[model samples]
Target chain A: MVGIDEQDVVARPGGAASPRRVQRVPMGLMIPAAAGLAFLVLPLAGLLIRAPWTTLPRRLTEPGVLTALRLSLQTATTATGVCLVLGVPLAWLLARVEFPGRRLVRALVTVPLVLPPVVGGVALLLAFGRNGLIGRWLDSTFGFTLPFTTAGVVVAEAFVAMPFLVIAVEGALRGADIRYEEAAATLGSDRWTTFIRVTLPLVAPGIAAGALLCWARALGEFGATITFAGNFPGRTQTMPLAVYLALETDLQAAIVLSLILLIVSVAILALLRDRWLTAP
Target chain B: MIEGMRRPGPVVDAHIVVDRGTFRLDIRLRIESGEVVGLLGPNGAGKTTALRALAGLQPLTAGHVTLAGGDVDRPERRTWTPAERRPIGVVFQDYLLFPHLTAQDNVAFGPRRHGVDRRSARQLAADWLERVGLADRARLKPRQLSGGQAQRVALARALAVHPELLLLDEPLAALDARTRLDTRAALHRHLAEHPGASLLVTHDPLDALVLADRLVIVEAGHVVQEGDAATITAQPRTDYVARLVGLNLYRGTADGQTVRVGPDLALAVDDPLHGDAFVAFPPSAVALHSSRPHGSPRNTWPATITGLQRNGDNLRVQLAGPIGVAADVTPAAAANLELAPGQPVWVAVKATQTRAYPADVQPSAMTRDAR
Candidate 1:
């Protein structure tokens, strides 16, 4: 039997009793906690175990692999930038302003988060494809069509990823103390100036966290990009789409691609943990 | 234009009326330049509502606000000035200094917003910090400063804009007792030097007495009393103000030297008045006795001790009878009398110690003439 001293574990700074203390784990809770950890970690462990390690370096250098990886990175970053430009103000309006039907509008903004990605892709295509509602006007007036293009991939990714950014930024805006804005007004700062100077800086951390989440979601997007952009090798194929195509003919290549995505995302998320993840 | 000539009109004159739900606040205020008026009230007495209305943060439901002889808000005329455009500065109760900016930048924020160049704005901020005696701590953030230092920084930030009117809400309420004393003295000096009109809101009587030139006491949503500190202290009309100033107040009808305080209790006050009046004296003036003593004291009443507590070095006993009164006695005297709750005792006060004044004079009418 292993015995632990409660006093040693409960020792706090300044010798004061901490309101929240980590107690010795009971078997009732310990079993489920370990099982939950295993449930999340086992799949990543299996990916590493089944990876074709010997051929990974050569497979990673393949032109198709590099093109897909590069497209995924470029499209995800651009989509995140688009989300930041459009979602931040929406979040601000939702958080700060009072208007009729605001609750309904907020619910509509979050529709993509719960909607099937394939449906969202279909919705985007119906809106922006050639001969589609808005797409026909664009094609007739400016000779522009978004379907089967790189820009379509970015549009689809942003459509699916924007809800994350808006939700995070709006929560940040809500949590910020509004009295500082009042103070700014008393100091002769108008509404726009106050928003740019005081409101933006206060919610910067939330925006950063939201943008990271959005970029990660965009990178993983497959169904929407495939449905809306129509996979062509270099023009529209992203990593997830290439991984899907590779799975039909070459299982090893698919495993290698999946391993790459997993490794890169895990590394990036680990690096960002100290920054946005730990913030209150 | 002569140096000694008085200004023609007040810097701020306003009548503010705000209605919210079932509560309504109506107040009229006028302040000349270089005068600090303290709005003193209890928790839900509309002091903050009046302050916000003056700052243009809240609109008046009726009436108008004129600052420096210019109309700022007039609900009847459909004219209203937003808070940002008004030439006013406010130090909020918590001193909401921008947490992300350093003290210097926070102080410079107002001037920069008013179109001052960055270099000159920084210079102005430095000068204001120096004036507040926090020049050495200008580079520190608000969280790094102590409560007193944060208050001084807030003051500097408000004054850097060079506003024509200044408003403070419970400026010293956030500080510890020791820090409040020091900060209050410093604030008094700055207010004396300020050339603009200032309005301060506080519930503490000490803050009003020590920092303000005049006090407007609000109860519920209206002004119950407004006078200089000496006048208010000497005579408080409402029971609230009486308790605030620590006086035993009673309303009665006076006939010559005798005043009927209750149905059976008539206090012998040394005043010659005939109509309805009020009599007031300090608790220290009341003498407690175990039995009726033969003496030259003119007033005496049988009272039952209801409660007793330590008041400074003496014990204050609350007694209930025909007229409720408080008597302060030394602890030794209390022990000798064997005083306890529900003990019967006799209370007396000399006729010369009590003051009688006419009661029918309304405070609102008095405030207009006093101002």
Candidate 2:
């Protein structure tokens, strides 16, 4: 290293022109990179060009479109809230505490992330639908059944989306310096206080990012929401369900709803990326 | 073993014994109120473990920790108080200042945890910040502060709790040399003002001598020696402690002025000590000769250079002979003699330069005579 620095200085004294830049992009890398970009952008371009732009405003303001959009926004937000309350603590337990079968528990938490969405919906129905496992008791005791209700949509969305939040928050918690919590402990802060005041603040950025990802995933939920909630016009139908149903008979309306959801998701992702996450 | 322990009424009394599969640390200590005890040792000597046990962070396998007359932990009785409930504060080696909190808020964290209201906690934190000479930097985050500034903030945060016992783990280890000098001086003043029992864990001899009122030298897993700084430097009991104090030390049986350090090696000392004893002298006291000189010093021995490295302005050579010793020689002399590893040389130390004392737990006359 010293020799290289000395050579750099000697070369500078001789006034040698700056070394030529190596602006090389290997064919091996460029080909795959271009292929990946094209694969991702082609469908989006198709959606834009095939969109019924002339009738977009009229179609978007339809009662069905407005109701589905409102329901999607509300359900996704509520699902995210439920995930935050339950998943944050679960993530902390996985990250901070030592217990038997911890590896198995972590794998179990991530199972939903990889599980088929329709399978998750079927599982949710078996667990919470009338005459199903917990749903049988819930219905008999309180006359409550989750299937085909707005609450059922939220349950389906949360079941599928919670893994994202848990995984992100758990990664953040594991990366955090545990010594800060020890420092807090030495300063008379109890375990609960330390977790709230020090650990949570230290991982706040991770929590926010996880929450955003979870909300996005929930907003786009279609397989689980449709299977479990049985898409009803205003009560349980979300934007994705409406788009899918419109696709069979009204392709133009389907395109308008898809475009609206796409625009909203892109805007949110762009705004949050600039404000919270670093750009690649 | 250390003297002056089990004093009438100590603020902190701990017997820490931790057993990791391969290593076990058993250390006992008693620190009185208003006294700063420096836990000085080499790496992995269990100094930090002892400190952590005292602070209630590490639980002892079979020992007790008592602070300010309260038995906080006694594992035998299954009694334990967690770290948060202890009346103690710790300044971690790297400061471990909460990066998300401002200087004032960091200090206020302790006060708030102790049940002080928000306004009062901030007020107390501001006062401590002022005392640490960081009043104007209260709003700055830890990363925004310089190393010295961050260390002071950590100190203020620890002190804001008014802990009865303060534990500092290599507090000045992270600062640069110049910053360390200033911070050590400031730390000395703050420690002097603290009325609580303070235990400072550091490997730096200068920090120990300057900040601690008493020094405890630990080696491996136990306390080898503990005394005032002057006494410790004058007579180090172990090689690790000797190195920390920058001295050449050896244990031997002494007859009059001659001490037999090994089967084939004995050195003439100025002290008239008998029985088991220790002889110590500075590296500079060793002189090297290419060829044996006339009227040789009785302490002379034929040695081969084992290693050579620059220590300050002089070259420090490690020699292997009947007794291994370190000798410092001027670079000019080294170059003239072509001193290198494996080179044969004669080493000498005058009788007047070597001091011998009893190698036992007797700290009475030996300590006074050495001074």
Candidate 3:
């Protein structure tokens, strides 16, 4: 019942003495914060500074490099599209509904976010590989094997990236006002109509941001793509796969590939960020 | 009653009965075409629940809801209409305008969903915007509109569908005082023109008196009183309703025009004949005198001021004595008498102005069942 001002001790004690000595500095807070900031930026800075300069154009213009980039864009875009179709509804269920195992369901959705991409790829293979449980039946009944194909690359990327969209969209759905839905209902609109007309528009910004995150994650996916789809030129090979393969033979080529990926991603993100902020 | 209401218009005949935990909502109401009934109640009094049930958002534990002569909800037959299919419109307490859509688009949304073509829907939306006097603001998003303007747009959205029934939930509660007054007058005019059966749920007594043909007062999910404002205000059956109507009410034994209140206090009235009767009057009816008056028509008593609150330009002084009552007096008068909490004063009411009636005016069976 007491007001906000009465509860703030810091605001009440305005006469506290200022630190006058260097020894009074608190390293417990400052040291870890600075170290954490550097730890994240240093690796990115290292990539930019160490990239190859000589023969860079020849490396970039190589048919194999262009093929990998094309494959990467195609698979990542497909993965992002799949995520949008499934993740939005899943996020809605998580944010709005109360069902048995809801908590378990939410936790399970985030497993890919926490699990190593290689482990996720292994799990997918176990579930969908030829001779696997459902995979064997699919192969026998439909001859639709999924592994070692471009489709497999998309599946792996989507698996590793979907959690980003689900988590972000769900948070936004929860934060958005639910009264608007009720209002829509009162205005003679049904649940689905309310969602399409009101809920989706209100949460468009969050969904766009989530989509960008999913796309970026899909674009950079390496371990899952390699483990599930393997490395094949013009088929399953993507930019990350090309970078990894080059690392084995030519570290300089790998650095150049890494730099290309970095610059392209930065450009795309900068262009899309404004659109995301202004979404519906 | 069912067969008689076959006209192509609103004729809502509903007896809504619902039990939420220990609270129960039981009300029988009827609204003919072009009628506006105000459902008035305090918070948690099931006003919203009744409105929701009418809108098919809440299921009734018992009773039936009929709109435009069709059975919307009948628990016995296990029939219920979903909110979407029901030809009813509701204006929510908070105008839930779609934040992304412009005001025109938001108003057009319902019409488009109901199968009106896009261009026509927009045209209808524009027409409704003008009806609510917001034509220039049609292109603005909901966030950009003022609260009153948004509320008007919400009303227009509900009206655009030409629903058989219209429901408004605390329509003015979200507005500032100045906006509320203006909006209330405008809403009154709109409701007057609306041909459908309109149900307005509000806790504000002034809104009920000003805009409704009849008042239905609910408390703790049950209809406590229902009548024209004057009847309910004059003969409130419960203490809650009495307080809302701003009357000091007491029930006791009455011998002729004189009613025995406490052991020592007997209120003298001009009305004759009584036994087990009630006496009711407003705080403004009581007059505070400097001392016990020698007048033959005034029933005076020595009282102590218990509390004081501002009521318009005067101070509403709560007095405690053999017969407790409230009196409104000017601050200057209060200061002249040197009035303060616990200050002794004399209060009186004209014998001719005092009203006394049968205390059994409220049926005990209903009261006991009500509790």
Question: For each candidate, what's the DockQ?
Answer: 0.75, 0.83, 0.58
Candidate 2 wrongly placed segments (more than 4 Å): A1-33, A271-280, B1-8, B335-338, B362-371
Over 4 Å off in model 1, which ranges? A1-37, A267-273, B1-8, B363-371
Global Cα lDDT for candidate 2? 0.91
Best by DockQ: 2
lDDT of 3 by residue, A1-280 (tens): 4677577755654545535434655889989999999999899999977877777888889898889999999999999999999999999999999999999999999999999999988988998899778789889999998899999999999999999999999999998998788767756677888888889988988988899899999999999989999999899999999999999999988898899899978976886767764554
Candidate 2 per-residue lDDT, tens place, B55-152, comes to 88889997889988778889999999999988888999999999999999999999999899999999999999999999999999999999999999
* Deviation of model 2 at A234, angstroms: 1.5
For residues B1-371, could you state the per-residue lDDT of candidate 3 as single tens digits?
01243476447878899987788898877787888999999999999999999998899999999989889899999999888777788899887778888999989988887888999999999999999999999999988999999999999998888877889999999999999999999999999998788999999999888899888888887777777888878877677778888888877788988888888888887888678877887887788877777767457889999999999999999899987788888999888988889988888888777677776655332353342
Cα lDDT for residue B61, candidate 1: 95
Predictions ranked by DockQ, top down? 2, 1, 3
CA-RMSD of model 3? 4.6
What lDDT tens digits, residue by residue, belong to model 1 across residues B283-314?
99999999996788889989999999999999
TM-score between model 1 and native: 0.92
TM-score of each: 0.92, 0.92, 0.89
Docking tier of model 1: it is: medium
